[model samples]
Target: MSSPPEQHSGQGKTSDRASSGKMAPNATNAVSFFNSTAFDTRVNALINEWHVPGLSLTLVHQQELHSKAFGFATLEPPRNCTPDTLFDIASASKSTTAGAVALLVDDEENYPHVQWDTTMSKLLPDDFVMAGDSYTNNVTVEDVLSHRSGLPSHDDFYFSKRSSHPDDPRTVTRNLRNLPISVPIRTKEQYNNSLYTVASYLVEKLSNKSFEEFLHERIWKPLGMSSTNLQPDKTREVGLGDRMSKPYIWKEESRRFQVLEYEQTPEAQGAGSVWTSSKDYALWVKAIMNKEAPINDEIYKGLTRPRIFSNPEDDDLDPFCSWQGYAAGLESYFYRGHQIIQHDGLISGFSSVHFFFPEFKVGGVFLGNSENAGTVGSGILVKEIIDEILEIPESDRTDWNARQHKQNDEYEESKKESQEKLRKELSANDDGLAEPLKLPLDVYVGEYWNIGYKEMVVQIKDERLYIDASDRTMAFALDLEHISNNTYFLGTIYDMLADGEEVDKIKVEFRFDANNRPVRMGIDQEASLDGQLILYDRVEESSGQGQQKVVVR
Candidate 1:
């Protein structure tokens, strides 16, 4: 990679504040940022504000390394963080397996002619009831490795006491097996830690070696990552445990960070639970960037290539993060034509961030023992580092991390304005409840269809109003609210007002007929039009109880 927009050659390792003035990172070639002060100030402010334990940052600029340390490793006897402080890398471990797969595939030593057709059933016991057929069975090892397994995140599965069972992983594995997969293989990208958990077994079946052994032989030893290890729960008692940083969550009432740990997940063994330091991870990043050295760029290219695109959601607050979309193992986005491969780690309280800019040949890793350390988005952090090193515009380096927030803010403003307009409009209307025109709950029973556009029905059985349409059905909440004399809202509500600056009113309205019968209709003021639910009522019920024919009126 070229040195920024300018040409600065002598700009690496020796470029630090405490160390030197002569070999400072050349400012001539790139926008050499002195953000260590600003960044440190911001970090300290965050630490004091959030009461985070420890955070370690490793920034590599043209082979120059800068590591900054802060805070205690734990709450009790709070120890100051050292440059060599070891933090649990959390799910950041996935990228390791991803890299291993890339290496294996590149080597083609025993790589199979895989697709989205391979079966876990063959690998495991027959009694295990995982969904899908030969199509899903044929799902390639690549499919699982890339997290395109078409299964919802198996997180809830871990809440059960069975999930925490020691020695036996089947408690967790059983939940994954029983999950009914909705999307078929190659249909949609779904993140599944369980599939990656099974990846260990997959590798073992093919290579006749444990996942640990394979990684050790193929990656860890080769990269000289002596510090990195897949910490097993069995050896934890014998003092052979990876030096771990337990996670923490903010307790508002107590106003202190509480230790957060998963009950049975340490035994999960396969998908997550790995530990190392920024210094060690720098070597891993360096190896990845300089792919030709050991694993070769072929493996690097396959692993880093954009297989699928995704927009990951941010959980700045709250205990867990919402679904962040998948981009193979690594997430990618163009920062002004410069592509970045990144991944984040979340194991309750502990958080880790890693991002690599392939174009600039630069990467950064941040391990935070604090839960809320993710407040500063990774994209901006990585870009600022890249921009400072390579002298690029910060705007070009910043990410779309703030996009959703901006959009949601705009939507909220619009909604507020719309609400004000609605308040004015409602006041303008002189109609009050002259008569409620309400009907008996049971009278609104039996599929009431709007006749043409679609079908929605209120099926009353055992005194419950169920909205039925074909295979889909939703029961109306018992506490129905009467908005107007003739209008009522049920279940979920949405206002379909026109573009701003008008008497904002519900474009889609539901109101009963003169007969006082509850009807499914959408109105934009003039007259009620049949809704989608009306399609199911085109025919009349002749002789069956609660079974009516559709007759689009």
Candidate 2:
């Protein structure tokens, strides 16, 4: 992995600033430090050592923004990642969504009187019903943003859902009450994307605009984030689509990065789906650093003010971050006695981190196109950059790189072992029943309904039994491989999960009536945190002639 030529966004202006010799003292120091050969060596070494395809980074100190790009956007084509190469920023999109909601709350005309403590019951529609204690109904907007709404990170509901399914934010909010609460409301903090979708919906309801539209109007367009957007379709439309970094995951067997198909979920946009480049993201950081106008001061303060302790027990254990707490959408922590605000974003193949120290007026954003890049690479680079900015003494660059390589090596080894075990188990049990098909394949093809989830339609498409859980928010057309008896394996989803990935696997077991006609479908979905098998009853017609046929014994 040779070091690719770095591209700067505003080189002409930056040169002028440098020549003018009028830069703020802190800005001058930051520019010298980040551009120093030592910083470049560490960053390039990390990229090469981790097999990262591409990475885009931006640094801001004392209001001066510096953008840099490294490696290939596509390994095969060998397109270098530029300052404007877009990468999905994942969970870093949270702050923008939260900021959108805050902006709406700040609007006098729309929200005459609405605060973070405002009850969900009052803000949301009458139909929304949260399970658990009476306290569940009293959850506030701030509580949702801070991950204290008694909900765990039920990420699968978003990650594994059908792409064709209606990803309306309102629908996400409606399903919240159906899931069990992880803890008593306001008692503990649990980070999840579901509530962010709910909060984004709140923004939509108040502003009478889509979350993306609100951000574009208030933040993106205003801040000059020309290459930043919530939708890939829009990115393509602007001709920046081709510049987007191809996502990749490290394959243990191959000992190389394997490219993954570009996947976009607008449904989870609120939680983690924003595409941006280093150059574009710098403008966002500039907005935070400047806190210029109407949107800045109020929204920035809300986004950074600590609302709940995220890791109270580990405050002393981790030397990297201390006094950890969850703010609106950002994590507020002290790094080496400097108040740092940050968030990390990890989707399928891309990982991103956006961190800033308000007190020091320094910030950095990193985007990488590899799975390992998101898991550990970004953190490593951040530490290196921070050390330089803080001027730490006798920086052990060699030791740092060595430890990072060891960590990644261990991860790959563990992943390989996990995949091998899953493969063997799946193969061994694939024919466990050794029984013939009990009924016609058509008997199992019908629309099954689950109240907790929704409709799962099993249909024969192109002469193959396919389950379309589009209504359940799963975009994949699950091909059912007949394993044994009435059991079927969802091959497509299962394959990805076998690789130690996050794809949800559904093992479908068709329950039959006395005459061997299917009456109910029992699906073991990976999304269920408690490992409960969800049962969906086959829908019967009014004429008494339907997929569910009653046969009395």
Candidate 3:
């Protein structure tokens, strides 16, 4: 459980602590923190070695602050991580709802079927229940937060496709309501979006208001968190979109975080969709510590409980992802005598991480515009800071390199497995059925250019259709359906279609005539052009016809 906030006597402490976080420790008493002398140097080294962009950390020990800002928020702009920089804290948002519901339960009657007993039927829209399954009939609110809901991480039905159903605004929650259950409820652990998707409804059901409206009036306004919010309207924008850290993703080959657009607009309440900065989020961390205020102990425990036990796949994307220490809302990792309560957030390009140790009352928050900055690496950095603060041993600290190595190995294996699948699909002629591209080798060769993208040259090298286009070089086996003469569908994100059926494969519209003559064409539709960013015919197709004299007839 989170510790109650102590009352500050204003006893010769730093003035900055009072304004930043009532619980912030005095900077003058930095010596009181573990090995205060070598702290800053260690923190800097970690960021530099990791190739992190901008990061902000605030460590509170006995009503004092040990906070630092490092690197640039944007490399070219030379924007730095300041005390006020905001970040998109992704899944870390699970805890906020956990905390909010816990606080509401304190004043209101306990919600109906809120615990594990309350199945998805009671919480989600009627259609969400699967046609043939009964086990999925009992997923609860707590189960959702804990990720124990036996739902598949992704359903082929929702495979990157958004439903245009008009009953509700398109959201992950509504999607869950319509999805088939992948596994039985509570039988095995799968990080289900359906659970948290339902949690948004529960928040609305119990709070007597929409989650956005409810949080704005109840939790946010009360806490004086002037900046934190869900939707940012640039017209009326203030702290919501202002002073925001530009989100970036690390380019492994380029060795830097590349700036990208923030695309998530959450109509649902929870499920890691909210946005806020380190400056405003520090208020939230302080609120979690202050049990005497609106945030109480009941809320703290709810937010920190172990929501799931064993996972068939322990290293899946979500928290509760690991078997050792993950719960509904917070991840539980052990460090010597202390069990850390933590959460991390990821949305589009922005990332945020929050960590609190209930033991020493030493907790910190990290926010970065760059997704690369706040992944497993962010967790290690926090533990490192905690070790430095509390004088904890290296044994208690996280091994960043080891953890990174494991993550890399897993990613590479997954990638190779994916590649193999793609290799097989291209050679097939049936729906998921096996057939190779029926065209002759030379027929597939040409400089293929469509409306928007740069030229993609098709060459037959090693008896394969080698495609070279904007920053990405791809090779497909010569086995693909001969669509007309030049156009062929290249399967999903990582594979090529085998079964002759479209099966929702991306339409690789070839810019060629029936006779296979090359022609420049235009592609206008909602496609995720880059970084999973949904561009609504967003980017203009490059014009190869630029400056050509029209001389129209």
Q: Which ten residues in a row have the lowest lDDT in candidate 3?
A: 1-10
lDDT for residue 3 in candidate 3, whole number 0-100: 13
Candidate with better lDDT, 2 vs 3? 2
- TM-scores, all models, native as reference: 0.61, 0.78, 0.66
Worst 10 residues of 1 by lDDT: 1-10
In terms of TM-score, which candidate is strongest? 2
- Model 3 agreement with the true structure over 1-553: per-residue lDDT tens digits: 1111221111112213553444434222332442343554554555555556667666555454545566555565566666566666767777777666555555645564455445656655553454344544655656666766655543122212122321122344545543334455555566544356457666776667877777777677887777777644421265345466666555555554556544443433466656675656666776775553567776666666675554445544322223445565677766545566777776545667876666656666777655556753355666555555555466655565567657868877876665455444443443333344444666545543322122334555455555422122111122223333244444333211111112222323334445654343222112322212111111123446674322111
Poorest 10 consecutive residues of model 2 by lDDT?
A: 10-19
CA lDDT of every candidate: 0.51, 0.68, 0.51
RMSD per prediction, one decimal?
A: 13.2, 5.7, 12.0
lDDT computed for candidate 3: 0.51
Q: TM-score order of candidates, best first?
A: 2, 3, 1
- Model 3: residues with Cα > 4 Å off, grouped in runs: 1-37, 62-65, 109-116, 123-136, 155-178, 234-236, 254-257, 289-292, 310-325, 389-399, 402-406, 421-436, 439-553
List residue ranges in candidate 2 displaced over 4 A: 1-29, 132-136, 158-165, 313-317, 375-377, 395-449, 455-553
